[model samples]
Target: MQDVADQARTSKTTAHYVLTGQDQKLRIAEETRRRVLRAATELRYRPNLMAKGLRTQVTRSIAFISDTVATEAYAGNLVYGAIAAAAEHGYLLFVCETGGDPELEASLIGDLASRHVDAYVYASLFTREVQIPAELHFERTVLLNCLAADNSSPAVIPDERQAGRDAACALLDRGHRRAIWLVGEPGEQVLAGAQRTEGIRQALSDAGTELAGTVDCKWWPEPAYEQFGAFLDDGGDPSAVICLNDRVALGVYQALKARGRSIPTDVSVVSFDDSDLAAWLQPPLSSIALPHRQMAAEAIRLLMTDGALAEHPVHVAMPVRLRESIGPPRS
Candidate 1:
C-alpha cells in the first residue's frame, strides 16, 4: 500500500480508497483514481484476500455439497449452473461430493463451516427427499434437486408432475388418444416416476382418454426393449407411448422398429429427461427437459436473497422440446 501510494504520489488513504473502489463514494477526483490504479498495475500489486476476509469477517465463498451429481455425466449441468450464478455474484464456490454417505456429508459441512463460507448448497443428482444432518451448522443453506425431510431448508427441485403432463399433452396434441407409460421401479430415488405417472394420467383424463397401461422397465434401455418387444408380440398397438425417460424411449424406439412400426407414422412417442440422445436419435425424440441448470440457478438465487433461507421449497418448471418423434397417429 505504501509503495503504491508513493509511486502514485498520493496519500495512503487515497490509495486505499482507490484500490478498494470506495473513491467514488468518497468523492475522490477521477484523475487521482486513475493514477492509483496505474501505479498498482505497474507494481503488479494484488490484494491479500485472506487478510481482507479476516478483517471483514466475510469470505465471499459458498460451499456446494452434493450427492453424486459431481460424478454423474447427465446431471453435471447442476454444478455448471451453480458455478455460473455464483461467479456472477462475485462468490467462489467449493464443491464436495458425499456419494449419499451421511458421515462424509456431516464432516464436509463441518469443515466448510469452519472455513467461514458465506452459504451452503446441498445438491442431489436426482430430485428426491433427503435427510439433512441434524448437527449441520450453516445459517444460510439451500438444497438443489432435493428436499429436506422436515422442510428445514430452502429447496429447489424440478416440477416432475408438470414434466409428465407436458409429455402426455404433447402426444395428445398430436392426435394420439391411447398411450402406454414405461416407468422405472418404485422407490424413493425414483419418486419422479410416480409423480410423472400421475401427471400423465391426469392429462389423459382431461382429454377424455386414459393410459392404456404402464410397464415397469426398471429404467434400463435393455429391459424396456425386451418388455416392449413382448408387448408388440402380444399385438399391442397404442397410438402413442409416454416413456418415463429418454432411455426407456430408446428401447421403445428399437422395439417399434423391430416390429416394422415407424415413429410418428405408426405411433407417436414422448418421454422425459430430454437427454443428449434425444436429438441424436434417428428421428429426433420429443421429450420433457429435466431443467437441471434452471433448478441450480434458482437454488443459488434463493440462497442469495434475504429470507430465502426459510423452509420454502421451489419447484422449477420443465420444458418440452419438440422434434420428429411426435406426430398425428396413423390415419
Candidate 2:
C-alpha cells in the first residue's frame, strides 16, 4: 500500500517485498496477503509485461490472427480452440481480425511482430491461392486451417482431401455413377477448393468411375442459379450432384427446385463442410464436417512443443460424416 511504503520511506513494490521477505515460499497469511490481492483485483491491476520483458528479455505472449472470417462460426471455432490450447502452454494470445483484406492482415502482422509476439498464428479463409505478404516473416509461425503455399509457412488444414474423397465414395458406393461437382469459383489462388476437387476426382478414379460434369458457382447465388438452370436445360442429368461446400449446395438445391426436381428422387445431392444448416435442409444434407477444433488444437500443440515449429508441416484430416442426403441413384 502507498501508506505502508510512505511510512517505510520506500517504493510500494519494494515495501511489500520487504514485508514479505525475498524467496519466502510460505503460503500467504490470511490477513495481509489476501487483503493486498483483493485490493489489486479491485483496482484491476495487471503486471506490466513490457517492463518485465525489458528486465527478462522475453515476453510470453503470442498473436493469433484470422483473415476476416471471424464472423463465421466454423472459423471462429478454430480461433477459440487455438486460444484455449495456447493458454495451456502458459502463453498469452493477442487476437487480430483482418476482415479478409490481405493488406490489412499484413499490416496487423507487422504491428504484432514489432510488439515482439513470441509466435504467430495466421488464420486464413479457404481460398485458391493465398499470398501472404513478403514483409511478414517470423521464426515461429503456423497457418491455421488454411494454406499459404506462396509464403512457405507451415500450415494445419482440416482433412479437406479426405472429406472430398469420402463424399464422392459415399455416392459411388450407393450406385451413383454419374455425378457432378457443384464447385465454387475456380480461382488459381483457391487451394482448398482445388485440393478438394482433386480428392473427389482421385476417389472417383479409384472406384473406376469418373465425374459426370463440373459446375462452377462463381460464389454467388444468382450466378449459380443461372448456371444450374443452363446446365439442366442442356440436359445436365447426372444421377448425383456433389457440392464443393454447403453454400454452393444450397444454391444447387434452389436451382433443382426451380426445375421441379426433388432431391434424391429426381436427383441425389451430396456436399462438403456439413455446415450448421446442412442437417436442417429440406432433407438433411450429407456433408463432411471439418475437424476445426482438433486442427486448431494440433496447430497450437506443434507451436508449443519444445517451443519449436515443426520443420515439415503436419497435415491432419478427420473423416467425413455420412448422412441421409446421399442415397442410391434414381432408377
Q: Using alpha carbons, what is the TM-score of model 2?
A: 0.82
What TM-score do all the candidates reach, one by one?
Answer: 0.90, 0.82
Candidate 1 C-alpha error for residue 102, in Å: 3.3
Off by over 4 Å in 2: 1-22, 25-46, 100-107, 179-188
Candidate 1: segments with Cα more than 4 A from true spot: 2-14, 22-35, 135-137, 179-183, 186-189, 308-310
| Residue 191, model 2: Cα distance from true site in angstroms | 1.5
User: Where does candidate 2 clash, by residue pair?
Assistant: 68-99, 68-100, 127-190, 127-191, 128-189, 128-190, 128-191, 129-189, 129-190, 159-317
Worst lDDT 10-window in candidate 1: 179-188
The lDDT leader among the candidates is 1
Give a tens-digit lDDT track for model 2, residues 77-196.
787888788888888888898887778877887788777777777777563335656655645778886666664777787766777788888888888876555456544456667777
> How far does residue 49 in candidate 2 sit from its true spot (Å)?
2.9
